[model samples]
Target: MTTKEQLTVIRRLMGFAGPYKWFFIWSVVLSATISGINVFLPWLLQTYMDRYLRTSNATIQIMWMFAGFYFGGMLVRAIMQFWQNYSSTMGAEYMLENVRRKLFSQLHAKGMRYFDQTPGGSILSRLMNDTMTFANFWALLNTLILALFAVVSSFIAMYLTDVKVALWTLILVPFLVMTIWYYQHYSSKVYRRMRERLSQLNTKLAEAITGITVIQEFRQEDRTSKRFQKTNQSYYDTRKAMIKTNTLLLSPMINLFYALGTALVLGLFGVRGLHEIVAAGVIYAFITYLNNFYSPMSNMMDSLSDFQNGMVAGSRVLRIVDDQTLAPQQHPVAGATITRGKVEFRHVTFAYDQEHPVLKDVSFVVEPGQTVALVGQTGSGKTSTINVLMRFYEFQSGEVLVDDRDIRDYPAAELRSKLGLVLQEPQLFYGDIQTNIRMYNTAISDEEVRQAARFVQADEFIERLPQGYTTPVLERGTEYSAGERQLITFARTVVTDPKILILDEATANVDTETETMIQTGLNKIQENRTTIAIAHRLSTIQNADQILVLHQGQIVERGTNDELMAQAGYYYDMIQLQNAAHKD
Candidate 1:
């Protein structure tokens, strides 16, 4: 990123801290207080040496009083340091939490097309690892505040001791400024590359774990391992570059400046001591003030690496929040709802990528309480039609209507609550049977849960388990068979009592017996609801009220089962192929 872009990203990230500005304000106040204390403690010793010790008037009582004042200043400095650290650290933590939540909500608001084009692992990295850097991001501000206060206060004290020495010490300022500029410009590039490498490493690991079953079955473990090692090595190389950049520019350079500045301050004093009397207290106060001037710079320089890392991470996170590939926009009229669930597509055209259409001028209608099955070969647009009708993707140049009104007129909540969807693979979370069936909808009572389970013919097997409806489910319900998992999903949908039921080739993965059981449940549920079914197996949707045969993103024929068979067109050819496969 360029300097302008980096500043823009930093500004956006700081916006999250607006709600906790008081904490930062207080931290700055405390830092200034501590700097004042630092200046006073050094001068107290100078006062005692010059006024009492040099005149040989030092009594035991005076000695105790000086010691007590020095100790009291140290105590107050410690207290100020505590509050400064606490307020600053907590404020940054709050900002990090808010940023993570906003990112998560933004991910949910993205359209299916966004997920289709992005990797799961890249998204995960930005949401989890990148967001965490923000908590440490504010440490840079605290260090900067301390350095600013310390530099000004210590310089004033030094100037009061000897104006000529103080003026000469500033020769190091221009060189220090040049070093800082070089580090920010170069280290930012290194940190950006480092963040990208970390994201790539996360991507490879997520891909490997998700497909581990396929990999082991195909005996591709060696190949996967080698690829992961290569990505890991790239990440390791970036770390080496980052460490080298920090070592070259941060504490080492700042410490070098401190050493040179100190030599200049003392060398001026030594020349004066030869020609005239230079008070011991004056030399002591001048050296102490010089140390104060340089110490905070070393700390600020040490935090520069975190500054760069946080900027890169913050930019990556904000990119998602600013992405335009959002879920389809809806213009709702109040009181509009999907009551009857009559769905229609009026010459709809749709595409995942705007340039190439996957659905072309598709028109179809399914009346309430009727079942319409979509049949076609792979990529023939059967699923695409369902996706458009379901309003999962924005259809280009078309109007999708439900209940004789534009689909967008209905509130999103109404559409989601009334339309039920069952995907090809059944998904279950880490919950018990009853909870999954109701989908954590607390309003769905135990009686309704059992009724829905029985409605889907899933009650028999579920009741046989020791814990029955309360049985604990593990990751994705791995303990359950595919058929069982799917039946539970069926119960999940049934419990919602949807007006329109959607099935995306629900029986393609089950065995013959489970398919038969699923069909029986499906028949009862389709009694008085509008249904849209996509058929992977030709036989599963043979009894649909109307069948639409599609080819190359267009509907070729539409009729009843026997009506389409008599035409001996795409429908008949598909049937013949399936029948032959069954016999083989």
Candidate 2:
């Protein structure tokens, strides 16, 4: 990212904390108070040395007063520091929480096309590491405030002690400013490179874990390890480059400040013969104050690099939020009872990529309670048809009507609530079997859940498992086989009792026995509902009232099974192929 882009990201991130501006203001106040206490300590030390230690005329009453001031300042400083830490850290956490929430919501609202183009690992890193960088910016802000107080207080104290020495010390300020400016300019580039490499590392690690099964099956573990090593090496190289540059710039800068101060102090005390005139205690105090001044300045400069890194991370997160513009609903559509699941696709045309259309001039109508089956080769637009009907993807130039109303006119939530979908790869989250069944509509009771499971014939296997409906499955239903997961998904769909149902390759991976069981359950669920089945198994959907065969992006054949069989076209050829494979 360029400098302008980074600044924009920082501005956007700061906006999240706009609600907590009061917290930031109080934190800065507390930080400055603590720094002010630090400035008073050197003056108190000088007083203690000159009046109490060097002179025997100092009384016990005066000693106690000095002691009280010394410890009192310490106590007040501690209190201010405590408040500063609490308030600043709280603000950072608050800002991070909101940023994380907004980023997640934005990502969820984005279309499937965005996920197709973005890497999963990169997204994960932005959600995790990027938020951390934003929090670090808060710490840098606190440090800068403290540094400001220290620099101002130290300059006033030094001038009061000795004007000539203060003038000599002030000469190094310009050089110090120039060095920090130069370092910040170059360090930002290094930090940006480091952040990019970190994102790549996250992406590579995610890819390796997600594809571990494929890697092991192909016996390519060594190759995968080698690739990971290359990524890791690149990350290390960038980090090292950043560290090397920082060390070279910062070490010299710190030494230069120290050398300048030491030379000025020595010249004042030795060459000018001022040691007898100036109190030893005052010179010691000046040295301590000078160290205090330079230390925070150096830290502030170093933290500027961290601030740049955080800005880069913030930019990545904001990019997602700004990129996708979600389609808005002006007003909630009045709930219209879908008594009949009549679906009509009127001149619907869609393209996953604009240059290549997936569904071209598609038009179809399904009467209420009718069963329609779509048959097509892979990528022949059967799935795409279902996707558009479900409103998972929008058609570029077409309307999908549900009960004679455009689907777009309905609120997306209400539209989806009326439809049930089961995919080829059924997903079961990490929850009890009962919870999984009722996931689609959680308002349903346990009894209703059981009824749905029984209707889908899932209650049988579920009852056999430990705890029956309460049985907890692992992630992705790892505890159960693929067939079992499909059964659970079917139960979930049945529980919702949607007006329109879509089954996409639902039985493609099951055994004959399970397929028979699924068919029985499907028959029970499909009764009196509008159903669309996309299947390669012609036998399962042979009884469908209508079957549409899609070739490329066009529907080439449409009729009942017997009607299409009589024609002896693409449908006949596919049936023959399946029969031959079965015989073999």
Alpha-carbon RMSD of each model: 1.3, 2.3
Q: What is the overall TM-score of model 2 with all chains considered together? A: 0.94
Going through the candidates in the order shown, the clash numbers are 0, 0
- Give per-model TM-scores: 0.98, 0.94
Candidate 1 C-alpha error for residue 512, in Å: 1.2
Span of 10 residues, lowest total lDDT, candidate 1: 134-143
Off by over 4 Å in 2: 1-3, 48-57, 274-276, 325-332
Clashing residue pairs in candidate 2 (N, C-alpha, C atoms within 3 angstroms): none
Collision pairs in model 1: none
Alpha carbon lDDT at 5, candidate 2: 72
lDDT of 2: 0.83
Residue-level lDDT of model 2, residues 264-378, one tens digit each, is 7767766656435667668877887787778777787777777777776777777778886443332446875466789999888998766789999998899988999999899
What is residue 147's positional error in candidate 1, in angstroms?
1.9
Candidate 1 residue lDDT tens string, 1-584 = 67898789878877888898898899999999999998898899999998899988899999999999999999888988999999998888887888788788889999898899888999999999888886687867787888899999999988887899898989999999999889989988899899999999999999999798999999999999999999999999999999999999999999899999888877888898899988888888888898899888888888888878888888888889888898887899988988888999899888888878888898989999999999999999988887876678898888889999999888788888899998889999997999999887999999999999999899999999999999999988989999999999999999999999999988777788998887888999998899999977878777888999888889999998899999999999999999999899
